[model samples]
Target chain A: MFRQSLAVTLINLKSIPQRPGMSIATIISVALVVGVLLGFSAMANGFRATVQGTGSQDVAIFLRSGAQAELNSGLSRDEVRLIEEAPGLARDSGGEAIASAELYVIVDGTKRSSGTDANIPLRGVGEDAALLRQNFELVEGRMFAPGSNDLVVGRSVQREFSGFEMGEEIRLGNNNWQIVGVFSTGGTVFDSEIWADLGVIQNLYNRGSGVQTVRARLENPDAIERVRAYAENEPRLNLDVQAEQAYYASQAGATSDLIMYLGWPLSIAMAIGAFAGAWNTLYSSVDRRTREIATLRAIGFSGFPAFVGTMAEALMLSAIGGLVGAAAVYLLFNGVSASTLGGSFTQIVFSFAVTPSAIIAGIVMALVIGFLGGLVPAIRAARVPILAVHAD
Target chain B: MTEDLRQDTLYQLDHVSKSYTRGKERVDIFTDLTMQIGRGEFIAIMGPSGSGKTTILNLLGGIDRPSAGEIAFKGQRIDNLGQGKLATWRAHNVGFIFQFYNLMPTLTAIENVELPLLLLKMSGKERRRRAETALDIVGIADRAGHKPRQLSGGQQQRVAIARAIVADPAVLMCDEPTGDLDRESANSVLETLQLLNTELGKTIVMVTHDPAAASFAKKELHLDKGRFVEREALA
Candidate 1:
């Protein structure tokens, strides 16, 4: 039976060279479907990669007890001081605890190229904050000087946001802050923000005697649980402590879920269109060869063999379409950079990754559609009356 | 009782009945029909429209089961056999030819002939050899590689004959075998049928309205409204 099916498959493949247009159309339709599906999947992958890549095992994020993100809550200046001075906290070269009192605010700004106005995150970091992230590097100009009205713009911020260039001054609530330098963290979510002094941002936002969040590095990475326990027991602070990576994970959920959900409809609709195209081609092939099919049955081919042959033709067509679609996706969308919001209330930029997994999925989908579309037509062909075999 | 008469008795039908349902009415096509044929016999069934002559060939070829009674080939009952077994029995024993040459357009004459042999577990080369032999017997071996579209009506009928005999079945059944041919083509097909009957000793059952076509056969069975009204043997 398998051998018979293989012979039928080969025969169908031979027919493709003669009808090049139909073959090309099938391939193009499949490619379009696969390409769209992979596009959305890549966006999700990029967002997850950006956020999950950000935090280290040693760092932790401190927020208010009921707040999910920094934008929704604030930690008082006294709580920041107390958390920084807590035991088990890592100390820098100057013997001060390695912690940063970070302030976050959404500042309305104009985007570059299109100049569309959007809200961009403005992060205020303490002196030790830069040292806490090992990947952060100044790509151009110098770092922002502490105690001055100076700021450092991330590379993505400089590219996407208007007036966010090195040495340029951008106004934040009537206070003018100079963009002293441009920096990048290679990957990770920090590559999409404007960083200034914590006190400057707190005063500008009128959040006196408080910071939006307190982030600190542990002396021993495994002491995260003890730190969480300690923060939970502190009756005065009412702080929420979590691993920094987990915090970024929460940031990734919203955009990732959206992209994944978008892929569902896109994949389904494309599969239906491609399936219909395949069904049209395969049904015609069966109908056109009605006499041939009857002749075969009359010549002693069992109904099973005849049916299998017809379906093999459809599957071969679909497989070809799947390959074409995968190739198109790889060529057009792989390594494409895109930006969206993250769980930490910050913008993240990453590339459209056409992973091997996505390609396999597309092929599977194509084959299934082919099977569904081809099986019924094949059966119909096999069941045609023997007298009608010669009617043609 | 004689050896010659016994050898001539290749098939027998006893008390056969067949009918079709048309709306609320029962259209009786054949009833209490009885028949007997000899090996090496070239027999023609002649009848007008609705005479059930073709229905007799269909039943004898195992393509359709009778509504009642028995059809026997070589003294064994066949009408009541299960469908699966009937198919296997048909494969080894019967060859059917239609008025229009039903060769697969996609296949060459040789491949068309080779189709019946596919049911047998033979190598492709063996099937091709047998197909060639069948075409050669039908006197059109040179046209084996030509597709059906490339062949004349007579040549196409010859290819159909080749396909019918490729499996070396014992009985050959043809329905309006020369109905779609010109005078010359029809004569050619009739000659081939005569040769198959005389030289191969095949038990042939042919249905035709054309008396000229029937004349090629050694015997004539006359049917009317589903009954075998008369039988005539020609020397």
Candidate 2:
């Protein structure tokens, strides 16, 4: 039976080229489905990589109670001093704590592409920020001097927004700010923020002798519990404490979840549509070869061989569709940078990632469509009546 | 005449009844039909469209089962065999020819002939050898590489016959084998059948509407509605 079915399957595949009309349509439809599916999921994956995964557990973030975002959080001068002195914080070689009291504010910017006004995050941080964000590097020019009206712009902001070029100055909050340095944070969301000295921003914006958030390098990742307990026990400094990675992960969820929600259901629906097309194509294939199948039946080829033949043809066509889809996504979207609104309501630049797992997922989806689509038609092929050859 | 043929009975149909459920209609094609076919005999079943001529051939070849009858092929009851066992029975003992030639459109003439041999546990080289010899016997070997569409109606029927005989089956059942061909092509196909019956000593049962085509057979049985009404034998 195995040998016979193999022979029948070979014959079925060879015959497809003669009637390429419907089968080709099925292939194209399935390809488009997989392409769309992979493209959107890849975008979501890239979003997660940039916005959520770049943070480390060894660093902790503190936000005011009931505040989910740094932009909406605040720290009093006393609260800042208290958290900075809290135990379980990592120390630098100079015997000072590796912590930074930070302020996050959205500032106006001119988009490079359209010259339209867009809001970008401008973060004010202490000197320890350089140590806490391990991948931060000044790619061009010099770092901002303390107690000066100088700002270091993120690489993405410099590339995407105008007036942030090296040595350039832009007016913000009634002060002239010079773009002294351009820095990168290894493709993290921080790459989209402009950073300035904490004192300069605190004075210019009249932020009331406080910051929006405090970040500290933990003695170890597990020491987050000690920090959280300290914040909770100090009622005057009642703040939410979490690992930086967890903080970013919480910030990353809504957008990536929305994109993924759009991706999977849309993909599955399109798959169902492609499955319909495949059903029509394969059924017509069986119908058109009715007499041929009947003759094979009459010649003692069992129904199982016919069933096997039809099923093999369907899978081959679907696999071709899957490969085409994967290739399309890889070529058109992979590593191509784009930005979307993040948890902070600011553009977070990221590149689309067509990962191997995404490709495998798309291919498996195509195959599932093929399998469901082919089942009924293959059974019909198997039961094709031998009398059809004599119906003439 | 039927009793005389029973002396070398290759097929014996006793009280065969056949019907079909077509949509809401129950179509009765044959009732209590009895017949005998001799070994090496070439017989033609002549009838109108609904006369159940092809049904008899199908039953004898084990392509179908009798509704209520006993079909004996060389004294073995084949009508009672299950579908799988009947398929094996048909593979080893029967070959079929059909009106439209029914050659697999994708396969070449030689490949179509090699189809039945795929059921056997023979080597590929031997299968090719047997298919080649069958094509040669049908005089269509030169066009063996051509697909069904490339061949004329007569040539396709000849290829179909080659496919049938390649398995070395004892019986060849043809249903309107030359119905789609022109007169010259039909005559050519009939002559090939005659040669297969006489030279190869293979028993043949063919159903045809044309008397000219029936003249090639040793005995012609004319069926009307359900029963055999006339029997004629000619040299």
Report DockQ per prediction, comma-separated: 0.30, 0.73
Angstrom error at residue A146, model 2 = 3.2
User: Which stretches of model 2 miss by more than 4 angstroms?
Assistant: A110-118, A171-176, B21-26, B229-235
Worst 10 residues of 1 chain A by lDDT: A2-11
Best by DockQ: 2
Pairs in clash, predicted candidate 1: A31-A325, A251-A343, B8-B38
Put down candidate 2 lDDT per residue, A338-373, tens digits, no spaces. Answer: 777888778888889999999999999899988888
Model 2 whole-model lDDT (C-alpha atoms): 0.89
Residues A1-392 of candidate 1: C-alpha lDDT, one tens digit per residue: 45444444454555555566766776677767777777777778777887788887788888998898888878887888878767778887888888998888887667664667666788889887787675989899887787788989888787777788777878877789888898888776787888888777877788786787888898877878888888777788787888788888877887788888989798889889888887777777777667666656555555676688777777777888788877877787777666666665455667777788878888888788788878888888668765455463
TM-score of A-chain in each prediction? 0.93, 0.93
DockQ agreement of candidate 1 with the native complex: 0.30
**What is the fnat score of candidate 1?**
0.22
Which parts of model 1 are misplaced by more than 4 Å?
A1-35, A108-115, A147-151, A158-180, A269-290, A344-346, A378-382, A385-387, B1-8, B135-156, B177-190, B209-222, B228-235
